[model samples]
Target: MTEIINFRAGRYKISFHILHILMTEKYENNATQVPSSDDTLLGVINYQKVPTPIYDLTRILEGSSAQQQMSDLIDLLHEREKDHVEWLNALQSSIETGTEFTKARDPHQCAFGKWYDSFKSENEDLKHILQKFDEPHKVIHSLADKLLKMAATEGKEQALKVLNQQRKSTLRLLLNLFSAAREAVSSSYKPVIVYTTLNGATPSLGFLVDSVDDALTIDESDIQSFVNDQAIKFAGELNLPRMISGLITKDDVNSLLIDPSLIDASLPEAYENEASLA
Candidate 1:
């Protein structure tokens, strides 16, 4: 079993041991400015006389050059989900009328697919979930050609039944994914800064996230594995490798787990002295 503190950062659920989070509060852009090439470094904050580096979790973890306005994206997703439902309805209607079914066969051509591809490749925490839609989305789009050919031999009624079955299965899955996508973004709130001063002797560090979620305990099995290829590619591309030790998205344990003990050492030693107010 593990005790974890779950939170949202750019539409992704992330968690770490509850013991690591000493306290959390509303972020107040008060970090003392410093010169560092590292973008994740949001400057330092004086906490208990120690210079604590405040990192922008949303900026670094989301794989976006600019932090996404989660609220706006939530509305966009709602509209896209509705568009997909209508897309399916139109396909059914065309099949029933014995007319040409002309629409985007290429998944990337659809409005939703365009946005999906354009979304900066999500970080490891979200890549797996987003990729789950690829096969289903492509399959749904390809249905028109397949069903239209089948209708000539199988009869309109049978073709219509096939379309309905697809609506219940593939389309339903996409809609659920859309809902989860919406939930992921809606989970965000005004940015929060979580401060940690582990055991008094360790360096205090602060993390800026979209919002904080509840703390809970769960069995070790709740921790999920990441795709090794995706993890490696993300780390290699970002160069600012996040020490995301493990990820879990089940029950109340949605989060990317990191060991707080490694946080200070993970950065360049120059960070420790950049703005040492202690």
Candidate 2:
């Protein structure tokens, strides 16, 4: 039941074994720091003290450097922050004055304003910091990881279906890299290649040119004991939220390269049983 994931980038045929961790999570040598370039897909999560960049396999396969991608995403958010602030101000004024638009034009304004106000008040430094420093798309990327996990344990069938849907929704992101290649003197210098692999015995490899990436197999072991128990399910719920994996594709030969030893030894078994019903 090994699911063969194939992605075409120029001429190379990328493939790998998908392994399911029985108990512990492994992130490319247990790394907790975000990768500095497009060649590494895994990132460190920095919810506390230092941020941890969780690798999105699909994005890595697509040729985006984790650090640069994260920074660019933060920049995009900063660019839109002004508009968000304006919208927040208008909503606040409407709510205070009881303007007709308060309810009719932006009914959700109150709730949204409250959310923004909280962030603004607590993190007044956020705006100033954004002006000087930018981070990558870790938040959304993290959310995508969580959602994918949900699809893994709670709804494997449904999750795979959602990934199929994302192919179309994420086309714009993929096109951006191609456009960058066109504008750059050398595509290699442009951070267009995403090097990524799930490290395990029987490691799995995926390639994504832009966002043409799909939900490669998300194989999870050590779940049979918790299949029906609420507590086990709860445990799964807690663990899956932070489990992240994805793929990205690119044109450069070096971008898609991964170390053979990084893959786990038990991957062959994982690949055969990635699907729940299988």
RMSD of 2: 23.0
Instruction: State the lDDT of candidate 2 residue by residue for 83-157, as single tens digits.
Output: 333433443443334343222123124332333344331122344433221122122122244444555476645
Location of the lowest summed lDDT over 10 successive residues in candidate 2: 233-242
Model 2 ranges with Cα > 4 A deviation = 3-60, 84-278
lDDT of 1: 0.72
Per-residue C-alpha lDDT of model 1 across residues 80-149, encoded as one tens digit per residue = 8898788888888787887666678788998889999989633443455577889889989888888887
Instruction: Pick out the ten consecutive residues of candidate 1 with the lowest summed lDDT.
Output: 233-242
Judged by TM-score, which candidate is best?
A: 1
**What lDDT does each candidate get?**
0.72, 0.32
